[model samples]
Target: MPTVLVIDDEDMVRLVLRQFLERQSMTVVEAEDGEEGLRLLRANAVDLVICDLIMPRADGIGTIMNIRRLMPAMKIIAISGGGRSHAMELLKVAEQMGADHVLGKPFTRDQLLAVVARCLPGHPMTVRSSARSG
Candidate 1:
Protein backbone atom coordinates (compact mmCIF):
# COMPACT_ATOMS: atom_id res chain seq x y z
CA MET A 1 0.00 0.00 0.00
CA PRO A 2 1.15 3.57 -0.61
CA THR A 3 2.33 5.36 2.51
CA VAL A 4 1.47 9.03 3.03
CA LEU A 5 2.83 11.46 5.60
CA VAL A 6 0.31 14.07 6.71
CA ILE A 7 1.78 17.18 8.34
CA ASP A 8 -0.64 19.60 9.89
CA ASP A 9 -0.80 21.38 13.22
CA GLU A 10 -4.50 20.93 13.71
CA ASP A 11 -5.58 17.68 15.28
CA MET A 12 -8.86 17.67 13.41
CA VAL A 13 -7.15 18.10 10.08
CA ARG A 14 -4.77 15.25 10.69
CA LEU A 15 -7.56 13.00 11.95
CA VAL A 16 -9.79 13.76 9.00
CA LEU A 17 -6.99 13.21 6.50
CA ARG A 18 -6.01 9.97 8.15
CA GLN A 19 -9.60 8.80 7.88
CA PHE A 20 -9.83 9.81 4.26
CA LEU A 21 -6.53 8.23 3.26
CA GLU A 22 -7.13 5.10 5.29
CA ARG A 23 -10.48 4.62 3.65
CA GLN A 24 -8.62 4.54 0.36
CA SER A 25 -6.40 1.76 1.72
CA MET A 26 -3.33 3.97 2.04
CA THR A 27 -1.10 3.92 5.10
CA VAL A 28 -0.74 7.26 6.82
CA VAL A 29 1.73 8.77 9.29
CA GLU A 30 0.82 11.90 11.19
CA ALA A 31 3.01 14.84 12.21
CA GLU A 32 2.10 18.07 13.93
CA ASP A 33 4.55 20.20 11.99
CA GLY A 34 7.13 20.11 9.27
CA GLU A 35 10.02 19.35 11.60
CA GLU A 36 8.32 16.25 12.92
CA GLY A 37 7.27 15.35 9.43
CA LEU A 38 10.87 15.44 8.21
CA ARG A 39 11.98 13.21 11.02
CA LEU A 40 9.24 10.75 10.16
CA LEU A 41 10.11 10.98 6.50
CA ARG A 42 13.69 9.98 7.23
CA ALA A 43 12.65 6.99 9.30
CA ASN A 44 9.86 5.80 7.06
CA ALA A 45 9.63 4.98 3.38
CA VAL A 46 6.86 7.42 2.71
CA ASP A 47 5.47 7.55 -0.83
CA LEU A 48 3.78 10.94 -0.45
CA VAL A 49 3.80 14.01 1.75
CA ILE A 50 0.55 15.91 2.29
CA CYS A 51 1.60 19.02 4.15
CA ASP A 52 -0.07 22.16 5.43
CA LEU A 53 1.63 25.36 4.31
CA ILE A 54 1.10 27.26 7.55
CA MET A 55 2.31 25.45 10.67
CA PRO A 56 4.00 26.16 13.97
CA ARG A 57 7.40 24.45 14.04
CA ALA A 58 8.88 24.60 10.50
CA ASP A 59 6.54 25.52 7.67
CA GLY A 60 5.59 23.67 4.52
CA ILE A 61 7.84 25.56 2.08
CA GLY A 62 11.00 24.78 4.06
CA THR A 63 9.89 21.19 4.40
CA ILE A 64 9.27 20.89 0.67
CA MET A 65 12.71 22.32 -0.11
CA ASN A 66 14.29 19.90 2.32
CA ILE A 67 12.43 16.96 0.84
CA ARG A 68 13.50 17.99 -2.65
CA ARG A 69 17.07 18.18 -1.48
CA LEU A 70 16.89 14.80 0.22
CA MET A 71 14.71 12.95 -2.26
CA PRO A 72 14.46 14.72 -5.57
CA ALA A 73 11.63 12.49 -6.71
CA MET A 74 9.55 12.57 -3.53
CA LYS A 75 5.86 13.34 -4.19
CA ILE A 76 4.42 16.30 -2.31
CA ILE A 77 0.92 17.80 -2.15
CA ALA A 78 0.94 21.07 -0.24
CA ILE A 79 -2.39 22.11 1.36
CA SER A 80 -3.15 25.53 2.72
CA GLY A 81 -6.36 26.95 4.06
CA GLY A 82 -4.44 29.73 5.69
CA GLY A 83 -7.93 31.22 5.95
CA ARG A 84 -6.04 34.50 5.97
CA SER A 85 -7.00 35.44 2.43
CA HIS A 86 -3.43 34.55 1.43
CA ALA A 87 -4.04 30.82 1.11
CA MET A 88 -4.00 31.00 -2.67
CA GLU A 89 -0.74 32.90 -2.68
CA LEU A 90 0.81 30.33 -0.39
CA LEU A 91 -0.43 27.52 -2.60
CA LYS A 92 1.15 29.28 -5.58
CA VAL A 93 4.45 29.49 -3.76
CA ALA A 94 4.17 25.81 -2.90
CA GLU A 95 3.88 25.02 -6.60
CA GLN A 96 6.97 27.08 -7.37
CA MET A 97 8.76 25.41 -4.46
CA GLY A 98 8.68 22.00 -6.12
CA ALA A 99 5.50 20.55 -4.68
CA ASP A 100 4.06 18.16 -7.26
CA HIS A 101 0.56 19.44 -6.47
CA VAL A 102 -1.29 21.91 -4.26
CA LEU A 103 -4.74 21.87 -2.66
CA GLY A 104 -6.58 24.57 -0.87
CA LYS A 105 -8.00 23.81 2.54
CA PRO A 106 -11.52 22.38 3.03
CA PHE A 107 -10.95 20.04 0.09
CA THR A 108 -13.04 16.93 -0.32
CA ARG A 109 -11.72 13.38 -0.05
CA ASP A 110 -12.26 12.85 -3.76
CA GLN A 111 -10.20 15.90 -4.62
CA LEU A 112 -7.43 14.80 -2.30
CA LEU A 113 -7.50 11.32 -3.77
CA ALA A 114 -7.35 12.69 -7.31
CA VAL A 115 -4.26 14.71 -6.48
CA VAL A 116 -2.63 11.74 -4.83
CA ALA A 117 -3.39 9.61 -7.84
CA ARG A 118 -1.81 12.22 -10.08
CA CYS A 119 1.28 12.43 -7.91
CA LEU A 120 1.77 8.70 -7.52
CA PRO A 121 0.49 7.37 -10.75
CA GLY A 122 2.14 3.99 -10.27
CA HIS A 123 0.41 3.30 -7.00
CA PRO A 124 -3.10 1.96 -6.69
CA MET A 125 -5.35 3.82 -4.26
CA THR A 126 -8.52 1.79 -4.39
CA VAL A 127 -11.28 3.29 -2.34
CA ARG A 128 -13.14 1.01 0.04
CA SER A 129 -16.45 2.73 -0.64
CA SER A 130 -17.90 4.86 -3.40
CA ALA A 131 -19.75 7.11 -0.97
CA ARG A 132 -18.63 10.75 -0.95
CA SER A 133 -19.82 11.43 2.58
CA GLY A 134 -16.46 12.92 3.47
Candidate 2:
Protein backbone atom coordinates (compact mmCIF):
# COMPACT_ATOMS: atom_id res chain seq x y z
CA MET A 1 0.00 0.00 0.00
CA PRO A 2 1.13 3.55 -0.65
CA THR A 3 1.77 5.85 2.29
CA VAL A 4 -0.13 9.12 2.76
CA LEU A 5 0.68 11.98 5.10
CA VAL A 6 -2.19 14.11 6.41
CA ILE A 7 -1.48 17.51 7.95
CA ASP A 8 -4.26 19.30 9.77
CA ASP A 9 -4.52 21.13 13.08
CA GLU A 10 -8.01 19.95 13.89
CA ASP A 11 -8.22 16.56 15.54
CA MET A 12 -11.60 15.73 14.06
CA VAL A 13 -10.52 16.56 10.53
CA ARG A 14 -7.44 14.46 10.88
CA LEU A 15 -9.43 11.58 12.26
CA VAL A 16 -11.90 11.75 9.41
CA LEU A 17 -9.22 11.76 6.75
CA ARG A 18 -7.20 9.03 8.42
CA GLN A 19 -10.22 6.80 8.68
CA PHE A 20 -11.33 7.42 5.11
CA LEU A 21 -7.92 6.85 3.59
CA GLU A 22 -7.23 3.78 5.66
CA ARG A 23 -10.51 2.35 4.44
CA GLN A 24 -9.11 2.66 0.94
CA SER A 25 -6.16 0.54 2.09
CA MET A 26 -3.64 3.34 2.10
CA THR A 27 -1.10 3.71 4.91
CA VAL A 28 -1.89 6.89 6.82
CA VAL A 29 0.43 9.08 8.85
CA GLU A 30 -0.59 12.32 10.47
CA ALA A 31 0.74 15.62 11.76
CA GLU A 32 -0.98 18.43 13.64
CA ASP A 33 0.93 21.07 11.74
CA GLY A 34 2.93 21.53 8.59
CA GLU A 35 6.24 21.51 10.43
CA GLU A 36 5.70 18.03 11.74
CA GLY A 37 4.28 16.99 8.41
CA LEU A 38 7.42 18.07 6.61
CA ARG A 39 9.57 16.32 9.17
CA LEU A 40 7.72 13.08 8.65
CA LEU A 41 7.91 13.43 4.89
CA ARG A 42 11.67 13.84 5.05
CA ALA A 43 12.14 10.92 7.37
CA ASN A 44 9.84 8.51 5.59
CA ALA A 45 8.61 7.81 2.11
CA VAL A 46 5.15 9.29 1.56
CA ASP A 47 3.36 8.82 -1.74
CA LEU A 48 0.76 11.51 -1.15
CA VAL A 49 0.12 14.43 1.20
CA ILE A 50 -3.18 15.98 2.21
CA CYS A 51 -2.55 19.28 3.92
CA ASP A 52 -4.66 22.03 5.45
CA LEU A 53 -4.04 25.69 4.65
CA ILE A 54 -4.21 27.55 7.95
CA MET A 55 -2.27 25.31 10.28
CA PRO A 56 0.18 26.83 12.71
CA ARG A 57 3.89 25.96 12.71
CA ALA A 58 4.43 26.34 8.95
CA ASP A 59 1.06 26.56 7.18
CA GLY A 60 0.06 24.67 4.07
CA ILE A 61 1.62 27.02 1.54
CA GLY A 62 5.00 26.84 3.17
CA THR A 63 4.80 23.10 3.38
CA ILE A 64 3.84 22.82 -0.27
CA MET A 65 6.61 25.14 -1.40
CA ASN A 66 9.22 23.38 0.65
CA ILE A 67 8.07 19.98 -0.40
CA ARG A 68 8.08 21.01 -4.03
CA ARG A 69 11.57 22.32 -3.70
CA LEU A 70 12.91 19.26 -1.94
CA MET A 71 10.79 16.55 -3.52
CA PRO A 72 9.00 17.71 -6.58
CA ALA A 73 7.81 14.24 -7.40
CA MET A 74 5.79 13.93 -4.22
CA LYS A 75 2.05 14.32 -4.88
CA ILE A 76 0.18 16.81 -2.70
CA ILE A 77 -3.48 17.64 -2.18
CA ALA A 78 -4.03 20.94 -0.39
CA ILE A 79 -7.23 21.17 1.67
CA SER A 80 -8.80 24.13 3.42
CA GLY A 81 -11.93 24.87 5.43
CA GLY A 82 -11.45 28.60 5.81
CA GLY A 83 -14.79 29.41 4.15
CA ARG A 84 -15.37 29.46 0.43
CA SER A 85 -13.57 32.73 -0.31
CA HIS A 86 -10.50 31.90 1.69
CA ALA A 87 -10.49 28.35 0.46
CA MET A 88 -10.53 29.49 -3.15
CA GLU A 89 -7.61 31.78 -2.55
CA LEU A 90 -5.69 29.04 -0.83
CA LEU A 91 -6.45 26.66 -3.65
CA LYS A 92 -5.00 29.08 -6.17
CA VAL A 93 -1.92 29.53 -4.06
CA ALA A 94 -1.52 25.81 -3.62
CA GLU A 95 -1.64 25.38 -7.36
CA GLN A 96 0.94 28.08 -7.90
CA MET A 97 3.13 26.46 -5.28
CA GLY A 98 2.99 23.05 -6.94
CA ALA A 99 0.28 21.15 -5.15
CA ASP A 100 -1.15 18.46 -7.37
CA HIS A 101 -4.74 19.17 -6.32
CA VAL A 102 -6.63 21.53 -4.00
CA LEU A 103 -9.86 20.63 -2.23
CA GLY A 104 -12.30 22.68 -0.23
CA LYS A 105 -13.24 21.51 3.21
CA PRO A 106 -16.56 19.82 3.92
CA PHE A 107 -15.57 17.62 1.03
CA THR A 108 -17.11 14.22 0.77
CA ARG A 109 -15.13 11.02 1.30
CA ASP A 110 -15.54 10.25 -2.39
CA GLN A 111 -14.21 13.65 -3.43
CA LEU A 112 -11.09 13.09 -1.42
CA LEU A 113 -10.64 9.70 -2.97
CA ALA A 114 -11.10 11.12 -6.48
CA VAL A 115 -8.46 13.80 -6.04
CA VAL A 116 -6.04 11.21 -4.73
CA ALA A 117 -6.77 9.05 -7.74
CA ARG A 118 -5.94 11.86 -10.13
CA CYS A 119 -2.78 12.76 -8.30
CA LEU A 120 -1.30 9.35 -7.64
CA PRO A 121 -1.76 7.31 -10.77
CA GLY A 122 0.14 4.11 -10.14
CA HIS A 123 -1.37 3.34 -6.76
CA PRO A 124 -4.43 1.16 -7.17
CA MET A 125 -5.89 2.36 -3.88
CA THR A 126 -6.07 5.94 -5.10
CA VAL A 127 -8.07 4.83 -8.11
CA ARG A 128 -10.95 3.32 -6.19
CA SER A 129 -13.52 6.14 -6.08
CA SER A 130 -15.03 9.27 -7.59
CA ALA A 131 -16.51 12.52 -6.37
CA ARG A 132 -20.01 11.71 -7.56
CA SER A 133 -22.15 8.96 -6.14
CA GLY A 134 -21.90 5.79 -8.13
Candidate 3:
Protein backbone atom coordinates (compact mmCIF):
# COMPACT_ATOMS: atom_id res chain seq x y z
CA MET A 1 0.00 0.00 0.00
CA PRO A 2 1.14 3.54 -0.70
CA THR A 3 1.94 5.62 2.36
CA VAL A 4 0.74 9.23 2.54
CA LEU A 5 2.01 11.84 4.95
CA VAL A 6 -0.61 14.37 6.08
CA ILE A 7 0.81 17.50 7.68
CA ASP A 8 -1.67 19.87 9.31
CA ASP A 9 -1.89 21.91 12.52
CA GLU A 10 -5.55 21.17 13.11
CA ASP A 11 -6.52 18.00 14.91
CA MET A 12 -9.87 17.68 13.18
CA VAL A 13 -8.39 18.17 9.74
CA ARG A 14 -5.81 15.51 10.37
CA LEU A 15 -8.43 13.10 11.72
CA VAL A 16 -10.78 13.63 8.80
CA LEU A 17 -8.03 13.26 6.24
CA ARG A 18 -6.64 10.20 7.93
CA GLN A 19 -10.06 8.55 7.87
CA PHE A 20 -10.56 9.38 4.22
CA LEU A 21 -7.12 8.36 3.04
CA GLU A 22 -7.18 5.15 5.03
CA ARG A 23 -10.53 4.30 3.53
CA GLN A 24 -8.88 4.56 0.15
CA SER A 25 -6.51 1.78 1.24
CA MET A 26 -3.53 4.00 1.78
CA THR A 27 -1.36 4.04 4.88
CA VAL A 28 -1.72 7.39 6.65
CA VAL A 29 0.95 9.13 8.70
CA GLU A 30 0.39 12.53 10.29
CA ALA A 31 2.34 15.47 11.67
CA GLU A 32 1.11 18.56 13.49
CA ASP A 33 3.34 21.02 11.65
CA GLY A 34 5.82 21.36 8.86
CA GLU A 35 8.75 20.83 11.18
CA GLU A 36 7.37 17.51 12.34
CA GLY A 37 6.40 16.71 8.79
CA LEU A 38 9.95 17.18 7.60
CA ARG A 39 11.21 14.93 10.34
CA LEU A 40 8.72 12.26 9.33
CA LEU A 41 9.74 12.59 5.69
CA ARG A 42 13.36 11.98 6.58
CA ALA A 43 12.41 8.95 8.65
CA ASN A 44 9.87 7.25 6.41
CA ALA A 45 9.53 6.40 2.75
CA VAL A 46 6.27 8.11 1.90
CA ASP A 47 4.59 8.06 -1.49
CA LEU A 48 2.93 11.47 -1.16
CA VAL A 49 2.59 14.40 1.21
CA ILE A 50 -0.63 16.32 1.94
CA CYS A 51 0.61 19.49 3.58
CA ASP A 52 -1.24 22.44 5.04
CA LEU A 53 0.05 25.95 4.44
CA ILE A 54 0.32 28.73 7.03
CA MET A 55 1.43 26.37 9.76
CA PRO A 56 3.11 27.50 12.99
CA ARG A 57 6.60 26.17 12.35
CA ALA A 58 8.36 25.93 9.01
CA ASP A 59 5.28 26.73 6.88
CA GLY A 60 4.33 24.75 3.84
CA ILE A 61 6.39 26.77 1.36
CA GLY A 62 9.59 26.11 3.21
CA THR A 63 8.65 22.46 3.56
CA ILE A 64 7.97 22.23 -0.16
CA MET A 65 11.29 23.81 -1.05
CA ASN A 66 13.13 21.48 1.26
CA ILE A 67 11.24 18.48 -0.05
CA ARG A 68 12.09 19.45 -3.60
CA ARG A 69 15.73 19.66 -2.71
CA LEU A 70 15.73 16.41 -0.72
CA MET A 71 13.21 14.25 -2.57
CA PRO A 72 12.55 15.68 -5.98
CA ALA A 73 10.50 12.70 -7.05
CA MET A 74 8.11 12.79 -4.10
CA LYS A 75 4.58 13.99 -4.85
CA ILE A 76 3.14 16.84 -2.78
CA ILE A 77 -0.36 18.24 -2.34
CA ALA A 78 -0.37 21.64 -0.65
CA ILE A 79 -3.56 22.58 1.24
CA SER A 80 -4.52 25.86 2.86
CA GLY A 81 -7.44 27.57 4.49
CA GLY A 82 -5.86 30.97 4.45
CA GLY A 83 -6.22 33.32 7.35
CA ARG A 84 -6.73 36.29 5.05
CA SER A 85 -7.48 36.61 1.33
CA HIS A 86 -4.19 35.32 0.01
CA ALA A 87 -4.86 31.61 0.20
CA MET A 88 -4.78 31.17 -3.55
CA GLU A 89 -1.64 33.22 -3.84
CA LEU A 90 0.10 31.05 -1.25
CA LEU A 91 -1.03 27.91 -2.99
CA LYS A 92 0.31 29.24 -6.27
CA VAL A 93 3.64 29.88 -4.66
CA ALA A 94 3.60 26.35 -3.25
CA GLU A 95 3.07 25.00 -6.75
CA GLN A 96 5.86 27.13 -8.10
CA MET A 97 8.04 25.88 -5.27
CA GLY A 98 7.31 22.28 -6.34
CA ALA A 99 3.98 20.99 -4.91
CA ASP A 100 2.56 18.60 -7.47
CA HIS A 101 -1.01 19.65 -6.62
CA VAL A 102 -2.78 22.25 -4.46
CA LEU A 103 -6.07 21.97 -2.58
CA GLY A 104 -8.14 24.67 -1.00
CA LYS A 105 -9.80 24.11 2.35
CA PRO A 106 -13.30 22.62 2.58
CA PHE A 107 -12.53 20.32 -0.29
CA THR A 108 -14.75 17.26 -0.70
CA ARG A 109 -13.82 13.60 -0.53
CA ASP A 110 -14.15 13.23 -4.29
CA GLN A 111 -11.78 16.11 -4.88
CA LEU A 112 -9.19 14.70 -2.55
CA LEU A 113 -9.56 11.25 -4.06
CA ALA A 114 -9.25 12.61 -7.58
CA VAL A 115 -6.06 14.48 -6.79
CA VAL A 116 -4.60 11.44 -5.02
CA ALA A 117 -5.46 9.27 -7.99
CA ARG A 118 -3.83 11.70 -10.37
CA CYS A 119 -0.72 11.92 -8.28
CA LEU A 120 -0.36 8.18 -7.71
CA PRO A 121 -1.80 6.42 -10.70
CA GLY A 122 -0.82 2.92 -9.68
CA HIS A 123 -2.82 3.10 -6.45
CA PRO A 124 -6.23 1.45 -6.31
CA MET A 125 -9.29 3.62 -6.96
CA THR A 126 -11.75 1.95 -4.60
CA VAL A 127 -13.82 4.40 -2.55
CA ARG A 128 -15.24 3.05 0.66
CA SER A 129 -18.66 4.18 1.87
CA SER A 130 -17.08 5.35 5.11
CA ALA A 131 -15.15 7.94 3.14
CA ARG A 132 -18.41 9.69 2.23
CA SER A 133 -19.75 9.74 5.79
CA GLY A 134 -19.48 12.83 7.92
Candidate 4:
Protein backbone atom coordinates (compact mmCIF):
# COMPACT_ATOMS: atom_id res chain seq x y z
CA MET A 1 0.00 0.00 0.00
CA PRO A 2 1.12 3.54 -0.69
CA THR A 3 1.77 5.68 2.38
CA VAL A 4 0.51 9.27 2.46
CA LEU A 5 1.55 11.96 4.92
CA VAL A 6 -1.14 14.45 5.98
CA ILE A 7 0.14 17.76 7.37
CA ASP A 8 -2.29 20.12 9.06
CA ASP A 9 -2.57 22.10 12.28
CA GLU A 10 -6.23 21.30 12.81
CA ASP A 11 -6.97 18.06 14.61
CA MET A 12 -10.34 17.57 12.97
CA VAL A 13 -8.95 18.08 9.51
CA ARG A 14 -6.28 15.49 10.06
CA LEU A 15 -8.74 13.07 11.56
CA VAL A 16 -11.21 13.43 8.71
CA LEU A 17 -8.48 13.06 6.11
CA ARG A 18 -6.99 10.05 7.85
CA GLN A 19 -10.35 8.33 8.00
CA PHE A 20 -11.10 9.05 4.38
CA LEU A 21 -7.68 8.04 3.07
CA GLU A 22 -7.64 4.87 5.15
CA ARG A 23 -10.95 3.92 3.63
CA GLN A 24 -9.29 4.12 0.24
CA SER A 25 -6.75 1.51 1.38
CA MET A 26 -3.80 3.85 1.72
CA THR A 27 -1.55 4.08 4.77
CA VAL A 28 -1.91 7.45 6.46
CA VAL A 29 0.47 9.40 8.69
CA GLU A 30 -0.47 12.61 10.49
CA ALA A 31 1.66 15.66 11.28
CA GLU A 32 0.63 18.76 13.19
CA ASP A 33 2.75 21.14 11.19
CA GLY A 34 5.12 21.39 8.27
CA GLU A 35 8.17 20.90 10.45
CA GLU A 36 6.77 17.72 11.87
CA GLY A 37 5.69 16.70 8.39
CA LEU A 38 9.23 17.12 7.12
CA ARG A 39 10.53 15.11 10.03
CA LEU A 40 8.10 12.32 9.28
CA LEU A 41 9.05 12.44 5.62
CA ARG A 42 12.67 11.89 6.57
CA ALA A 43 11.79 9.07 8.92
CA ASN A 44 9.32 7.24 6.69
CA ALA A 45 9.08 6.45 3.02
CA VAL A 46 6.01 8.48 2.13
CA ASP A 47 4.55 8.12 -1.38
CA LEU A 48 2.65 11.41 -1.21
CA VAL A 49 2.11 14.39 1.10
CA ILE A 50 -1.21 16.18 1.64
CA CYS A 51 -0.16 19.46 3.22
CA ASP A 52 -1.97 22.50 4.55
CA LEU A 53 -0.74 25.81 3.21
CA ILE A 54 -1.11 28.02 6.26
CA MET A 55 0.64 26.51 9.26
CA PRO A 56 2.88 27.37 12.21
CA ARG A 57 6.65 26.65 12.40
CA ALA A 58 6.95 25.94 8.67
CA ASP A 59 4.43 26.79 5.98
CA GLY A 60 3.39 24.52 3.10
CA ILE A 61 5.40 26.39 0.47
CA GLY A 62 8.62 26.00 2.39
CA THR A 63 7.82 22.41 3.22
CA ILE A 64 7.01 21.69 -0.42
CA MET A 65 10.29 23.25 -1.49
CA ASN A 66 12.21 21.16 0.98
CA ILE A 67 10.38 18.04 -0.07
CA ARG A 68 11.12 18.72 -3.72
CA ARG A 69 14.75 19.13 -2.90
CA LEU A 70 14.87 16.02 -0.75
CA MET A 71 12.57 13.83 -2.84
CA PRO A 72 11.77 15.16 -6.26
CA ALA A 73 9.96 12.00 -7.18
CA MET A 74 7.51 12.22 -4.28
CA LYS A 75 4.02 13.55 -5.09
CA ILE A 76 2.44 16.38 -3.08
CA ILE A 77 -1.08 17.73 -2.72
CA ALA A 78 -1.36 21.22 -1.17
CA ILE A 79 -4.57 22.09 0.70
CA SER A 80 -5.77 25.21 2.54
CA GLY A 81 -8.96 26.92 3.69
CA GLY A 82 -7.29 30.32 3.38
CA GLY A 83 -7.53 32.71 6.28
CA ARG A 84 -7.06 35.62 3.93
CA SER A 85 -8.45 36.42 0.48
CA HIS A 86 -5.29 35.05 -1.07
CA ALA A 87 -5.83 31.37 -0.33
CA MET A 88 -5.98 30.51 -4.02
CA GLU A 89 -2.84 32.54 -4.60
CA LEU A 90 -1.00 30.59 -1.95
CA LEU A 91 -2.16 27.31 -3.42
CA LYS A 92 -0.95 28.45 -6.83
CA VAL A 93 2.41 29.25 -5.28
CA ALA A 94 2.44 25.81 -3.73
CA GLU A 95 1.95 24.28 -7.16
CA GLN A 96 4.81 26.35 -8.49
CA MET A 97 6.93 25.25 -5.56
CA GLY A 98 6.34 21.59 -6.46
CA ALA A 99 2.97 20.39 -5.21
CA ASP A 100 1.68 17.94 -7.81
CA HIS A 101 -1.91 18.78 -6.94
CA VAL A 102 -3.79 21.54 -5.08
CA LEU A 103 -7.10 21.29 -3.26
CA GLY A 104 -9.16 24.03 -1.69
CA LYS A 105 -10.85 23.54 1.65
CA PRO A 106 -14.34 22.04 1.86
CA PHE A 107 -13.40 19.58 -0.83
CA THR A 108 -15.51 16.46 -1.10
CA ARG A 109 -14.21 12.95 -0.41
CA ASP A 110 -14.62 12.14 -4.10
CA GLN A 111 -12.37 15.06 -5.01
CA LEU A 112 -9.73 13.86 -2.59
CA LEU A 113 -9.95 10.31 -3.89
CA ALA A 114 -9.73 11.46 -7.49
CA VAL A 115 -6.63 13.51 -6.86
CA VAL A 116 -4.94 10.72 -4.92
CA ALA A 117 -5.67 8.24 -7.65
CA ARG A 118 -4.33 10.60 -10.26
CA CYS A 119 -1.13 11.20 -8.35
CA LEU A 120 -0.51 7.60 -7.41
CA PRO A 121 -1.63 5.68 -10.46
CA GLY A 122 -0.17 2.40 -9.20
CA HIS A 123 -2.48 2.41 -6.18
CA PRO A 124 -5.96 0.97 -6.67
CA MET A 125 -9.00 3.07 -5.84
CA THR A 126 -10.84 1.53 -2.92
CA VAL A 127 -13.87 3.38 -1.65
CA ARG A 128 -15.76 2.05 1.33
CA SER A 129 -19.56 2.42 1.62
CA SER A 130 -19.38 4.86 4.53
CA ALA A 131 -17.24 7.24 2.50
CA ARG A 132 -19.95 7.48 -0.14
CA SER A 133 -22.61 8.44 2.41
CA GLY A 134 -20.31 10.91 4.16
lDDT of 2: 0.84
lDDT of 2 by residue, 4-26 (tens): 99999999999999998888888
- Each prediction's whole-model lDDT (CA): 0.86, 0.84, 0.86, 0.86
What is the Cα-based lDDT of residue 128 in candidate 4? 31
Q: Comparing candidate 1 with candidate 4, which one achieves the higher TM-score?
A: 4
**TM-scores of the models, in the order given:** 0.90, 0.90, 0.91, 0.91
Q: Could you tell me how far off, in angstroms, the CA of residue 104 lies in candidate 4 after the best superposition? A: 0.6
Least accurate stretch of 10 residues (summed lDDT) in model 1?
125-134
How many Å off is the CA of 76 in candidate 3? 0.3
Supply candidate 1's per-residue lDDT for 99. Answer: 89
For model 2, the stretches where C-alpha displacement exceeds 4 angstroms are: 82-84, 126-129, 132-134
Task: Score residue 71 of candidate 1 by CA lDDT.
Answer: 93
- The residue-by-residue lDDT of candidate 1 on 1-134, one tens digit each, is 88999999999999999998888788999999989999999999999999898998799999999998999999899998846688888888888888888888777777788788777788777533332211
Q: Give one digit per residue, the lDDT tens place, for model 4 in 13-70.
A: 9999999889888899999998999999999989999999999889889999999999
Worst lDDT run of 10 residues, candidate 3, spans 125-134
After TM-score superposition, the amount by which residue 69's alpha carbon in candidate 2 deviates from its true location, in angstroms, is 0.6
